[model samples]
Target: MAKKADKYFKEDKWKIIEEGFNPDYGMVSESIFSLANEYMGVRGYFEEGYSGNKLIGSYFNGIYERSEPDYNHYKGVADFTEYMVNSVDWLYTRIEIDNEQLDLYKSDFEKFYRELDMKTGILTREFVWKTAKGKRIAIKFERCLSMTEVERSTWQASIKALNFNGKIYVTTGLDFSNIHRNSGENMWNCGEKFIQADKNITLGIEGTTINTGLKVSSNCKIQADYESMEEIIEDKLVAVKLCINLEKNKEQKITKIIRNLTLKDESQKEEYEDKKAKIKDGRDDVIVLNEELKEESRKWWENVWKRSDITIDNDIENQQGIRFCIFQMYQTYNGAVKGTNIGAKGLTGEAYNGNAFWDTETYCLPFYLFNDREGAKNLLYFRYKTLDEARKRAEVLDCEGAFYPIATISGKECCNLWQHASLQLQASTAVAYGIWFYEKMYNDKAFIKNYGLEMLIEISRMLATRGDFDKDGKYGYYCVMGPDEFQMMVHNNCYTNYMGRFTLKYTIEKVKEMKEKYPKEYEKVVKKINFKESEMNKWKQIIKNMIIPYSDDTLIFEQHDGFFKLPHVDIDSIPISDFPLYNHWSYDRIYRNDMIKQPDVLMFMLLFNSDFTKEQLKANYEFYEPRCIHESSLSPSVHSILANQLGKEEEAYDFFGFATRMDLDNYNRNTNEGIHTTSIAAAWMNIVYGFGGLRSDGEILSLSPTIPKNWDGYSFKLTYNDEILEVKVNKEEVTIKTLGNKLIEIKVFDKVELINDEGYTYKFT
Candidate 1:
C-alpha cells in the first residue's frame, strides 16, 4: 500500500501489501469490525497519529439513516429523512499535549499494532506514543460491536504507566454542535452529540425542532475519570488536560484507584467511588470464571465465517478489497430501530444524517433474510411499528392508507425533494417483496398471518390510493417517478407499474389465505383497514391493464412513457470527481440525462424473477447496465446479481467490487459523514447471490455457480426453506451441504431443480 503523510488517506491502490499501525491516537490506532444477525463488517486505522484525520469506521445492520428529503410531500404522505437516527459516532477523541495536537504525523511514536482476531470479534489496539517533549506512554484499547444483547454498544480501554513523568491530565471531549441544515439538503454538518457523557456515559442528541440539540439526559451505565494539569503552550502555561505524567499514571493505578465518572442528565453527576466499589464486588469471581468476552466474539465470527466466508483468487488485493468493504458495514449497524442505519458516509464523516434508501428493500434485505430471520423481521417490524405514523403522514395530505417515508430517522418522512420522495414510494412494493422473501426462507407462517399479511394489505391499499384509473380502466400511477431520479411527473413507469401490480397480487393472495385460515382475523383486518371489496376489484383491473412501456424489439424497458423522447447522454468517459454530478447540475438537468441512481428494470426482474425469461433477463441486463450511473451506493450489488443471473461474469465481479469498496476506500469520497450501512448489505448479497449464485423461487432453493476468474472458491450458508444448506463453488461446479441426508432438489436457474445428495454439487454453466 502507498504511504501517507500527517494525513492518513487510505491508499487502496495496492491490495496485497500489509499496512502498519500507530497508537498514540487512543481510538485512532484501533481497527474495528462489527456484525449483527443483520450484516458483518471491519475497519483499520493508524493509532499513533494526533493529526491524521479524525478516525476510521465500519458498520452494518440495522444500520439506520434519515438520508435525504422527499420533495413531493404535496402529493403522498411522506418522503424520506423522517425515519432515521442521529446514531452515536463510536469514533472519538484526540488528546492534544501542550499546544501540539495529538497527531501521529506530528509526534514521535513506536510499538503500534492493531489486530482483529477474526475467529473472535475482539479488536485490540496497542502502541506507545510520545509528546514533542519526549514523554512516552503505553496503552491498549479493546472494542467490539455487540453480537449478544443485539443493538447495545460497548467498549473498554486499559491504560498503563510507562515512566515517572510530569503532572498528567486527560479530558474526554464530546462535541455536539452539528445537526441543522434547512437547505432542502441533508447536510450533516452538525455533530449532534447523542451519547450521554455527562457524569457517567450518558448523552442525548437529535436534530429536532431545535438547532440539532443533543440533550444527553439519559444513559445505561458508564464511568470515567481524569485529572487536570498546567501545561506550557506557545510559551505560556495554561491549565488544561490532554497529557499527564507517567508517575501519575502509575500513582492512579497503585495508591488510590482512579475515580470513575457517573453519568446522568446534564444537571446530574455520578457517585463514582461508591459505584466503583459495587462494580468491584464480583470482579474476583469474574476473574476466576475466565470470562471469554473476547473469545465469544471470536466464536461468533467463526460461525459467520463458516456460513459466509469467501475466498478470492490469488489476487489478495481483491480479497482485501472485499474484506475492506465488509468491515465498514459491520461497524455502523446500531441494532435498534430507534437508530436508522448509517449512510455511505459510515461515521467516518457525517453526510446524510437520516435517510433510508431503497437499498433496505432491494439490496440489504436478502442477506438478512437468509441468515438472521429475526433481525430481518425486526427491520420489517420497524416499518410496521411506524405504520400509524405512516398513516398520519397520509392524513396530512388528505389521503388514505399509510404512506411510508422516502428518507427518515423517526419512521417519518424527512426528504423534501418531491421527485426523490414520490419516486421512492415504490420501495414499499419491494418491502412487500421482502416479506415474501422472509416467508420463502423461513416458513414462519404465524409471523405472516399476523404482521406480514396486515402489512401487505395496508401497502397494497396505499398503492391503490396512490394510483389513478384512465378512461379505458387501466391503472396509471401518474405524476410519479421511478428509482431513476430522472423523468419527473411522468406517467406509469414500467418498474413502478409492475411493482404496483405485484403488490396488488401479493396483497390479495395474503388476504385470501387469511380469509380461509383465519376468517375472523381476515374480517377484522379488512374492517380495520377500511378496505372496501370494490377496492380489490379495482386493483385487479389495474393489475390486468397497467401499461408497462418496454420495447422488446428495441430491447429496452422505457423508464416511463416518453422517456426515450427526452435527451439521452451516456456517461461514457466522465471524470471521477464529476461522478457526483448533483453538486454541479440542477436536479432538472440530472433528470434529463440517461443517468439512473439505482436499478429499475433490474429491480423488477430480480423481484419478479419468474415473470421474466432467461432472454429477457439477458436483454434487460445488457440494456440497463451501460445506462446505469449507479449514483446510489445501493445500485452496484443488485446489478451484480442480475448480471450474474444473465451470465455477465465480468460485469458482475466488477460491480460487486465497486459496491464492496463504496465506503471503506471512500471510493465515493464522502465518508466524512457516516458510512452507508444499509447499502453495503448489497455488497454482501453481491458475493452470496451473484458469485455464489443463490436465489429463491418462493418454494425452493436455487443455485447457479459462476466463480470470478479471480476467486479460488466461494461458499455461503443459507437457511433455505427452513433447511440450512451450504452452497460451495470452485471454478466450475457448485456444491451444497445440508442436514438429514435428504435428497435436496435445487435449481441451476429458477427453471431447473436438480436432486443432489446430502452434499449437492452442480457444474458451472
Candidate 2:
C-alpha cells in the first residue's frame, strides 16, 4: 500500500505549527522546520541533543567535497563527483540540571510545541521538563538566520524554575565533526581553535578537501547571567561552559550570536591567516544581538511581502501553503551573491548531492524573473561564467559547441549515470530559453548583447550538431530521453525538438538584432568567439525543418516517434506499494510500456503557450494526464497550470494542492531527504500563472483570471517593465492596478486595455 500523507503541521496563515511532538516524525519535522539565509542553512535538529531518528544537516552554499569516480571501462562517464559537504553544527549545545543530562528521547516532558513563523523567519519551541528528583523547569528556544547580514545567526533560550530554585549548566559551541548522512563520513579537518573564558567566546576553523580549497571560520559570543564560566577545547570542537542560578518564578535567558566567514579565494586565505593571529591575541569580533538580527530580518521580509505576497480569501489551507512556498523561495535565493545557483535541495538536505538540474531554468526562473529581476540575471550569468567548462564538456562529447551538464555545481558534470549525462539536451536548451525569457521580461538588450548572445549562439550550435536529418528528410534527435524518464533512448522526443527549434530561432533573431543595433560591440563579440556567417545559415535551416511529432486525427502530438506503438498501461491499476515505481519495478519494466514518469508534451506547450491552439492543449492534456504517474516533484504544477487553461477547475485545484504541500505534508514520503526546492518555486507559479491567468509568452502581458469555487477572492503582485501590477480576482470581475506612474497596456479576456495612475477592471461575461 502507498504511504498516506503525513499531515502533522497545523494550518495557520502565518506559521507552521506542531501541536505535540512525535518521535516517529523526527526527521520529517527537521526538514519542515529548517532555516536558511542564502549563505547557509541548518536542519531543525534539537539543540539539547536528541537520540532519536534524525539527520543533522548544516550546509554552506558553495562549499563541497570531491570523491574519486568508480572505475568504469565506458567512455564519456564523469571522472569525479562533487557533493555539498555537511558543515559545522553552529547550534550544538548540551544542558544539565541537578547533575542530570537532558536528552529529548530519554527525558520526561510535556506540553511540547514547535512553530516556524513565516512572517518573521523565526523558529520557536517550548516545553516543560521533569527532572529525576521532581524539580519542574520550563524552557523556550528561539533561533533565526539574519537576512540582512548573510553570515550571522542568533540562538536564544529562556528558562524558568516552576517549583524550586536550582542550578543549570549549559555547554554551547561550534562542532566540526558533522557526518554526511549519505556518505557516512566526516569531510572536514579542524585547523585552528581559540577560546576566551573571560570574554565568554569561542572560535574555530575547518577546511575541506584540497580540491575544493575552501575553509570556514565560525566565531561565537555567549551572553548570560552566570555565576561562573569555564573554557573547554578538544579536537574539532571548542566550547564555553556556564553555570547559572535560577529562582522560583524567575526566568533567565542565554543567547549565542554566531558569524561564519568562508575563505574560497587564494587571496582571502592570506588575509584569514593574518586574522587568525589576532584572534589568538584576544581580538574581539563585532557581534549583533538577537533582537537586532530579528528586527532586521523582519523588515526585510516586510518589504518582500509587499511585492510578492499572494492574498487569498476564504481559504486557510492554501493561504498557509502559498505563503510557505513564497517564504522558502526567497530564503533559497535572492541574488545576494553571484556565481551561485539554487540546488535541487536548496541547502535544506543532502539529496541529489546538492547539484542543480534543469529545473533551475524551467521551474525556478519565472518566480525570480517576476519578482527579483537581478536574481534572474544572476542565474543566467552563472551559465555565462561557466561557458568555458561547457565548451570543454562539448569537446569531450565530440560536439561542435557548448553542451551544458545535466547536473552541475562549479560548472562541471557531476552525474555518474552515463545515460543521463550524455543524452539529455534539455539543460542546454533550458539555458537558452532562460536568456530569452529574461530579455523579453526586462527588455534589457544590453544584457543580451553582452552576455546572453554568446551563450545562446553556443547552445544553438550544440543543438545543430547533436541533431540530424532522418532518412525521410525530417530533422530530429534520436537515442534521447525527454522530460519523462520512463521512455529513454527514443526518437525525436517532442519536447526536445520543440525547445531545440525555439533556441535556434531565438539565437538567429538576436544575432541579427545585435548586428543592426550595436554593430561595433557585435563585431567585438564575433571576433572574440570566432563567429562565422555559415553557422548562422545552418541554424536557420535546422529551425525551418525541425520535425515535431503530430497527428491530425487525434489533434495531439505524439510524445515521441514510436510512442504510439508501445503497449498502454493503466496507471491507476498499479498497486500503491509500487508507487515511486523506480523503487518497486524492475529497471527495464518501466520503459516497456506507455506510463510516463512526468509531463513531456505538455511541458513544451506550457513554455510556448501562445504557439498552441486551445483545442490542441485540451486534446493533449486529456490524453496525457491519465498516463502520468507524477513520480517527479516537478510534475503536478505543470499539470495544474495546463488544467486551469483548459477550464478543468476542479482538476486544477486538486493538482494545485499537491504541488503546494508536496513537502509540508510529506506527500511524496521522501521529504525527509530535503525540501523540493524547485517544486516550492512551482507553487508560486501555480498561483500567479495557473489561477490568476497571467501569461507572458505573448507580445503584451495578459491575464484571464479565474477563481476557484472555494475561494471568495484572491490577489497577487507582478513586476513588468519596471512597474508593479497588482491583480485582484473575485467571482464577479477582475481588477488590475499599477503601483508606478508609467502607462501600460495588457490583454484582459482577449480585449486590449490601458492602465495608468488609475487601473482597469473587467467584468465577467
lDDT (tens digit, per residue) of candidate 1 on 680-712: 677777787777766675456667667788767
List, in order, the clash count of every candidate structure: 111, 0
lDDT of 2 at 278: 53
lDDT of 2 at 162: 98
Q: What is the C-alpha RMSD of each candidate to the true structure, in Å?
A: 7.3, 1.9
**TM-score against truth, every candidate:** 0.77, 0.97
Residues 293-379, candidate 2: write the lDDT tens digits: 899889889999999999999998888888988989888898877778899999889999999989899999999999999889989
Candidate 2 TM-score to native: 0.97
